[model samples]
Target: MQPWTDRTTPRPALAALLTDVVPANRRTLILGPHAPQLIESVLAHSSDVTILVRSVSDAQQLGEDFGPCLQVIAGALDGLQTPPYDVIIASDGLDRLLGYDSADLSWTARLDAVAALATPDAVVVLGLENEFSLLNLLDSRPPHERHGDDEWRPLHDDPTRPVSVDQFRTALPWQAEVYADFASRTYVRADVASAARPGELPTRLATAAVDQTDVPLLSPAHEGLDTAARAGLLASVPTGWLAIIGAQPTHDIYTESAHTVLTATQTPTGWHLTTTPATTSDTSDTASDTTGAAGELLVFDPGVVPSTISSGVSVESVLFRLAAAEDVPGFRKLAADLGDWVTDSRVVLRWDDVVYDGESFSHGVSGWVAQETVAKEDLLAAAWARFHGRLIGQHRRHPWPPWMVGDDLVSAWLGMSGVEAPEPTPATSPDTLPVASEQVAKGKQIAQTLDDLLGITNELADLRTVLAEAEAAKHELFEMKGHVYGLERTLGFRNKAMKTRENRIRELRGQLQKMTAAHDRIRDSRTYAVSRVIFHAAQVRKPKVVARKLVRKFRKR
Candidate 1:
């Protein structure tokens, strides 16, 4: 197989646009490389179709697919000469039509050559990729197409190439209608005024295109799209413009929803959109105010559900908006109503899953059912519980104090959601932590999720250290307690000895006092006084002195 270049891949939305624009049973010419699906779509309407390709292998493959119906020419556009046909399609811009053998042609020269191939009344279709596209700015990968091996002369280097939507329209020879193409082709096919109306279909479709882009961007494309919409510039942010020369396309905007591509045609009463059944769905579908009435956008299959033109702002978007604005009262009022709605409806837990245009609340496009039966109260609690983590983690600003976070904040959110929040468990540090505990959702995206897992791993490691420290501290405390008990026993024995010594000293003092009183009474008696005076007169005698000494010794005893 030849390496495909400048191939028009089958886009269902783009196909619908092609079918509506291209007429039946006409002579057609498709230049450069186009996907088999696109060729088949062209053949479905054309009588005699000719496909011109620079790849010889592709030409051979086409010959086999359509033996006689398709006339395949395998050469550069400059080499092959062709008569004018009723319709001409060059989906890939002028650059891809040039081959190795052909001389380098300016964009102006190439346009002139393509014009020469068409008849006076020929309907021409062309695709011009805008240089200032978000994809071009966001794409971080190395060269694949823009300045790759195939593109000898890069489209950017060409001074004559059209840059903007207006420039692209002016570049076309005929008065062509230009459309801003994204994930779905032909989202903005009407005047700027009509597309830029209150309906958010263009913004949603554009942002959906951003989400579907398969490349890493500088920043989140969703955020960028939202910024663009708010600035009133979404109508002109084109990845590429599909310009049609002869035929004016019938429809205004073609957008895709849950399972189907919907055509939004404005009517007298209001706009008509498709709807799906109110069942539990998994993926969250992005919605617009123009959705078949704020929350009532989804339907089973092809059916035009009429919706009035009103401010059908999604409750989810509104809540987020309120949170961003730090409007606690506004957020509370809406969140309470949302909780009530979720409680009543066949529940999809996300706030974004429901829509409210101020008057009533209904289901938005995307939905899913719970795996096991869950109470509506639990659904409301768990969703906000999850959102609570996102609020703090995403650094969402709120009027609540800094201390009120995590579970405390979750309780507050649940209260606002109109559910009586469960009372908080009082805080206490556990003596020991288990090696592992079940982990619930933390509202972390991929990068932060990796960090969170790393953080958990680090905490687990830290927990091991903590356990070791605690074990050591416990042993030390046990030893200290034993030492204190021993000290108390020793103090008791010392106290008992001191009390015994005090009692003996008190008894000895009482005996001394009684002896002193008896001696005083004897000295005061009259007979004792006379004997004392006689003993004093005979004090010189040795025998009396000896007796006196004996008496004194007896009294001391």
Candidate 2:
């Protein structure tokens, strides 16, 4: 029973046992580092399966692969409700790796809590490796020669020097014991296999069929198979089989063409199909049909991707890029397949630091290609740098930039810009300061200036009226002065008339003395009296009326 080589073979056995013995319509809770694979297999057998992951990120990945069909819970088992699953299987990821004694119930209590969540009579399954048993299978290396036993150590710490299963087990003592104890019943046993050679079985377990082969989960340099052979094996895995491949030494595994091919295509059920002959140009409908509509989910280790972390670059980064490259046609097919599944689907892609999406003008890809290839750039890095610079500049300008923009105001600002602003709340709001009010104030000032101008115009109009009145008064004064001069001339004429009357009186006196005529003297007296009366009337008369009357009187005189 070379379990590692025949990873898919156990599924049929497990499926048969489940469908034949266990009742249908049962809900299963799968807990493991690689629980997705088991869940995928179980889903094929049963639809009512709920997967619980330890981390939020894991849940997201599961959702992406399963298309929201799977319900994921993030809390640990200790906090979960009872009877949550009909059958529960905790895969390679258990607290066992954390160095607790195998006999302790702490790890078991966690499992019990998980099992309690299952339906009554539900069987609890745990996937684990026997460390002590496996250590016996190493290439007879001394105990001191083995690497450290820290569970967090990189999978590829000794890539060039592949450690045998027994050596690895010896290095990690508590890990194997924990695995052995957690299972209600064990199906895949690592005891004999870990102690045996790659192709051989242990004499003690050889007679019994419960055996396994020593195959490196990752690339092993000393292993007979090279990278290409391993890749071929990975690609050729049977349908309904999902593989979670991680890189050694924290290197990326999705980069190489082999990894790319694996990530690009998905297995539907079995690996029996012979390799098709390469065509100069694949024009067939099936060949061109790139839809990965039906296949197992392939999850690549994102930690190996340098773009995801701030750590140094590793070979694993290459793996992700390669997978992305090979997935062009496959992913497009998947998108089409999912068309009927979702009312709306959005894919946001960021390469260096530049972000793009399916909604963008270019449909996520910024640069163009040869109509077949996708150009990959280190855009995520660039975008991150630019974003940091902008943030720093903003911080320098504002001590509390976030606080400056209240939650509601930020939303309003975003709304003004025609973007979907979040609701105005503490959690959803941004903390930028308000400046639009200042603009409004400036506008008010402009209006006030206009009003002042209007008032000035009214004052100018009033001054114009006053100037006209002053000019009229000046003209009336000039007319009054001319009247005074006319009156002075009339006075002079009256004085001359009086002098003439005196002379006439003198002449009358002379005539009276010379002629001694009573009749002439009486006539002169009458004339003098009449002339005096006429002069007095002329002096009392109005200007025009008096002048006209004086002319008539003079004519009579």
**Per-prediction RMSD in angstroms?**
16.2, 33.0
Q: Which residue pairs in candidate 1 have backbone atoms (N, alpha carbon, C) closer than 3 angstroms, thus clashing?
A: 275-298, 275-299, 276-298, 276-299, 280-368, 281-367, 281-368, 282-367
Per-residue error (Å), model 1, residue 258:
5.5
Q: CA lDDT, every prediction?
A: 0.61, 0.33
Question: What tens digits encode model 1's per-residue C-alpha lDDT throughout 51-158?
Answer: 988877778889999889899988887876878888988866676787877888877788888899888888888877677776666555555544555444454478
lDDT of 2 by residue, 1-557 (tens): 00111011122222222332334456766664443444565666555767654455656667788875677765445555645566665544344222121232343455445545655555555443333222223224444443343222123223222123334334321233211211111222233122222211111112111112222212211132112123322111111111111101111111111011101111232011111221112212222232121111111222222222111111112222333365444433432332222221111112221211222211211111111221111111222222222233222222224444333332332233232333333333465433433222322232223222212122222222345557878898899889988988898898899899999999999988777676667658978789878888777847888779889999999
Which consecutive 10 residues in model 1 have the weakest lDDT in total? 435-444
Q: For model 2, what is the C-alpha lDDT against the true structure? A: 0.33
Candidate number of the best lDDT: 1
Instruction: State in Å the error of residue 35, model 1.
Output: 2.7
In angstroms, the error of model 1 at 44 is: 1.9
Candidate 2 TM-score, true structure as reference: 0.26
